[model samples]
Target chain A: MRSVALQKGLAIAVPALVFGFLVAAQWATLAAPGSRDVGIRYIDPLTASLGRLQDEQTSLKAQLADVRAKLDQLQRAGAAQNGTVRDLSAQLDDLKRRAGLTDASGEGVVVTLDATRAAADLTQDRLPCFAPDLTDIVNAAWRGGARAVAIDGERIVASSSVYCVGGTIVVNGSIVSAPFTVTAVGPTSSILAVVDDPSQLSDLKRRRDQQVVDLRIASVPAVTLPAYGGPVVVRSATPQ
Target chain B: MRSRVGGAAVAAVALLLGVLVVSQFRSRDVYSRSLEQETPESLTTLIADLNDRNRQLREEIFDLQLRVDRAQSQVSGGQGTLEESQRQLEQLEVFSAQSRVTGPGISIRVDGPFDDHALSDLVNELRNAGAEAIAVNDARVGPRSWFAAGANGDLVVDGTGVRGPWTVRSIGASDVLYVAMTRTGGIVGQFQLIYQRTRFTVTRENALDLPPLAAQ
Candidate 1:
């Protein structure tokens, strides 16, 4: 009778303990930060919203291009008929070029930044390429007297901003991922001088040394940068 | 007989636990697979970018409509074509940092030891807040303007050395710019966080003038 009772206790206790363990494990997994629950709850809606916005942007860009083409045609026709208009057109073209409204190509330096293998490892806490990192590279090129600058094909303009939305970097309202390529058109030697200097780009250099980021800088004879295709609105300031 | 019945009951309980564990594991696998490509941070960023893009698109639509009107006027030989062109040129001149601009805006006076990175971040924050024109000390901030550390730890804006007690003037809507500068988690707050000794005095002015870029 005693042996039978002991076996009965063992049978019940073993399964009960196993069931409790399983329940606790499942609960812990669900309750932890960055768990499946959080990911599914937030990511799905955000991604869907992003897709809709991108679609809207594409449509708007198409409309803007159409209007711009029309304006160009009208200006060209006017320039052909009137000398004053022709001169004004030339001046406008120069200003537009200066304002980054037109494509530019010249000798300059190209800096490419990529996350290293270490950064790819999930255990690493720091990302080698952030908004500030890209901003620093762009600024360094400008300090070296770049005529025009583009990052990942988005032209830098007065109103353009480089910022991080999350882990991704954004420039002029466009999403850009690494490996980020910063192309600057100017005096090649001067641009390279600043971009390659460790003192000037200390943060990037530190990361490069740590194998966090792979940074490559080279001078090219000619690099073409696309025009500023983003909005050009001055809603606040009036000429004073 | 009692032992046999107990064994069957234990076997049933084990099978039920196995099924529950398997189901939970399967659900977890599906959830992780769905989220493998994106982290929560990345997803949040995507949402913010989308919102910003939509706002920009709205602004672009407004600008394009104006351009269309201008083009139609020019095509019809309207007398305002030259005036329109001149107006557009002036706007571009201000935007390209080729001319002086004055408007209601905000000025921030910062007194502390800060690096070029901080200053650049400040300028970027102003731009993000829709500053039409910006100037640090006397140097105009342009599209190509860059801030760097000068010799002796001085801040250099496009090669112009500027020390502490830096005054940053921006041209934009006074109220909007003011709120942006003073808001929680704004540039001023961020600066204070990083530079503990920094003092930032932000004032909204009815009229502030910003000079053009110095001749290069």
Candidate 2:
């Protein structure tokens, strides 16, 4: 009986020893860097790296803003002490308005241009909407005496470019999509009348008639156009 | 005596076995947490986000230089008034995140894959929910911020690459924002419909800081 017990003990102990050794070896492999195990991987380094880069970028931008604010303050102080500079400053304000550098608010018409759901449902050769459609509407609004205009809240400036990039509209380096809401700050009736004008609405009406796009024009009591966010690209062409 | 010796050896082996097993388990845990292969879609999103950010930064820097030039040219009587107006405008812009802003806010953590449009929609929801200011993983979402497919086809905000789990912070009524985000058919609810496995959480704090466009 004692001999039998010993045999059983040996059987259990030997297998246990082997299992432990196997576990140890597996542990070593898993602990090693670049191990093939799927479960052992940590955070994606690309994500981490990108996060770090963005952090640096944010810090730098804040610093730049601070510096600009200080410099602006100094220049303003200098202007306060000078005579000709004050006149120039007043002119600058007007220029800023014309350039769309400042925000504006007034009675205007809000025009919404959206791709028709039907157009999206059906496969077609030509797109239901185009950048020119937006451009044309903007031109019409201006013709109707719009002092300020904005597309999806992005103020349209002299240097602002409206073009198509793969079905999406690029406005001032930003991508604006269908259901574009164009707000014009001016005489509400005139703005609405301009959009309603047959000649001005010819292309938009045609698109609507062809079931290519949907248009909505409404007069609002008050509309605030955001300041233009894009850079003043022109450096040399000074009032010529 | 022989029985005693055999029992001692067995106990020693058992202890060694336990240690090895425990070590293996720990190592496996560590290994799984260290590295992961990103899907091509996610990689694309990251690259696109980076490119978009670079473009935005470049444009912003150009704008800043123009402003500085305008400021430098200012030399007269209304100069003080101009300065005051400018100072006020800068403050307003900072508040609007036209410039960078830092203040108290709430943070929402989202995990797993998400669509670019959905993220933008989520931000919109937050705004509707009364969030005064918002940021995603430190990226500020201003008026011009957009969510689009990158060159590699990943979702990016403005130019910042979005990856799960995204941390979103908003300065507003924390409770309102939380309820709005987690409400049924709201942003969080909508996100769940698309990604069942995704995790969404919101934490309100007295002070949540957000950087400006550049730092965010």
lDDT of each: 0.76, 0.60
Prediction-by-prediction clash tally: 0, 25
What is model 2's interface RMSD?
16.7
Cα deviation at A31, candidate 2, in Å, is: 50
Candidate 1 chain B: 10-residue stretch with minimal lDDT: B27-36
CAPRI-wise, candidate 1 is: acceptable
Docking class of 2: incorrect
Instruction: Give the least accurate 10-residue stretch of model 2 chain A, judged by summed lDDT.
Output: A231-240
Give one digit per residue, the lDDT tens place, for model 1 in A1-240. Answer: 989777886777578657755765675555433443332566677667666776777677677667666776777776676677777888888888888988899898888887654344432233333688888988998989899999998899998888875456678887676778899999988888887776888978997788667778889987789888777767666666
lDDT of 1 at B167: 94
Candidates in order, TM-scores: namely 0.79, 0.43
lDDT of 2 by residue, A113-193 (tens): 776544543422233336667766776676577888888876765335465433445565454555788888988887678
